[model samples]
Target chain A: MLNRVLHRRTSALVCSALTAALTGCGGGVDVIGYDVTIQQTSQCTVTGAAARNCEDPAVLGQTSLAARWFLETADDGVSVTVTTHEGRTIPGLLFDNNTNVINTEGCAGEGGRCVFVRRRYQTSDVNTGCSTFGELIFVGHFPPDAPQRLVGRFSDVAGNTEECGTPTINEVVFSVNGAKVEQPAQSLEGARP
Target chain B: MNRPLPMSPVLVGLAIGFAGCAGDGIDFFEVVRSRVDECAIRSNGEFCVEPEQFDPPTVEVWAVETRAEVALLYVDEEVWVLDPLPGDADPATVERTATKTSVVIDGLTGCRTDAVREVGFLSVVTRSAFGTTGTLDGSLSVRSVLTGPESCGSTPVGERTVDVVSGTVSGP
Candidate 1:
């Protein structure tokens, strides 16, 4: 009977709708993940520097050392959650190379460039404290004749009297540059001397 | 011959089983969905309102200008580690740690203002070290109450939605 046939089809539709709802609620999807580890080395330039704490007023005006970083970005990158040694989760941004660096101070100074890039949002556990730390990810094609190193200086914008150095990153692997290239001892952290 | 009526006990037991599964178990799902819905609502308030409460947080970032003596300038920042206070945990337990060690500025300062914008989860360059003349890179977490340019008034907005975002800063 037509009623019997219609009943069978209706049952099938109900089952299909339930499956779709569950899947839409963060189920049955393959998501990619990754992790990053940062290590500090002795290559830092500043010496005898006062520690800067936000909670303290006396040391309020000072330039803390720029934390050096090296990052990797991938679309098919494996999905692995990241946590600190202290059992805390770390939030990170996708590495993008195509960014613009602009100078904030007048052109009279040499080191006033700000790099801008779009964000690539991944995932995190909402219940946990896991979140993202927005840092620029580099991904783009450099001109064949583009210079390898960009020049700049670091100064104490605060009244504190201290000599700081440049920021550099070493051991860079251009993963997206068509050819897999590796540069040993790439320094992107320290101030240029 | 005609079939007799189904047994009374059999029919009653079947009805009870159907009612139990349909009524009680379904509520568990409803509870979870409601929790998520509440979070989504909170995220909306965080995005739409300015200088959202440091409590019941959704997403926020900070830019700290640590103006020290002329010779030694520095910047340090802190941000909420967890989303705004949900029902189960104590709000005071949400502690924030800097992205890196060695630098100072771990805690909130006394000169905090309430003026804030709905930045969601974005990190603004709170401070740039001196060597960044050519290109400087930095990162920090912000406290909602400390770093803002304005102050939140009494009877602040309630029941807002919040979002978690990952961001980056590069170039000069």
Candidate 2:
């Protein structure tokens, strides 16, 4: 009988501990980071819009690649900057729902690979439920070995340029390397015609 | 004959005490707010007050995944900058401020949200030291799942920018 009672007491304590951990009250949430992952890869061909030197057949298809993006922010009484894994500065907007809005540019490298980079400062007024984010997308070719760096400043919603209010929350960095991207199958079927 | 059952006030008191103790916890809103700030600082290194000076945040921190790919949409998030004609301040500047905001991305495809559509808007409000406040609006839309010339070759891979608006802040 005594053993059973002790076992019950231990079980209760364990359950309580687990509850606190899951609720993020017992330092659970702090131990983990907050952000979502976004991956993107694209394919382009020399057709329809502008016909350049065709390296690969103008096969209408998508160049599929797997990418990953994580985001975190700090308040500087003004705007927030997002950073990526490769130490590249991320510029984009943030929507009211706390979503990360983004825009990207790339310059082509050897073998017709282009890479471009940019960033935006997204901010929202929590107390008043007002929110804002930056957004953009760049689709084009860049010469191999084009400068692979992005440096710029943050602007207010009204297009007024400003600097980082807090030094710690300023600046961002990222990196991009050549990777093999697969073409979508549907495009292959469509291009056959 | 029936036997009387025993009642324990001590047990009832313990239960009440435990319930009270469990109520102590950090606020969810506060924690999420802090986390948002942390994410901004981590990605941007430094936060800016002005949208014109804003640059793209970093993508290095994320681990690439292809499964969550969203279809290309007609409209996408864009950034724009709009500065009011010096001293164009007015009480209605709040709603009109979004007009002044700029687009970070040049081309985006989407229709405005209406009663038929429930597209969301992310906005931010700022109050200057001189009691002037403004609101910045950023619009986001999902990618469409149709094959087209601009569909990134059938499978939409990346997010695009559509439009941005800026105006003076409003609200009580």
For this target, which candidate reaches the highest lDDT against the unseen true structure?
Answer: 2
lDDT of 1 at A126: 61
Worst 10 residues of 2 chain A by lDDT: A28-37
Mark the regions of model 1 whose C-alpha exceeds 4 Å error after superposition. A1-81, A84-86, A92-193, B1-172
Candidates' C-alpha lDDT: 0.25, 0.26
Poorest stretch of ten by lDDT in candidate 1 chain A:
A155-164
The sequence of per-residue lDDT tens digits that candidate 2 reaches over residues A87-114 is 2344433222111222333321222322
Tens digits of per-residue lDDT for model 1, B52-71: 33344232222211111000
DockQ of each: 0.03, 0.02
Task: State the lDDT of candidate 2 residue by residue for B91-118, as single tens digits.
Answer: 2332211111111111122211111111
Q: Model 2, B40: alpha-carbon shift in Å?
A: 27
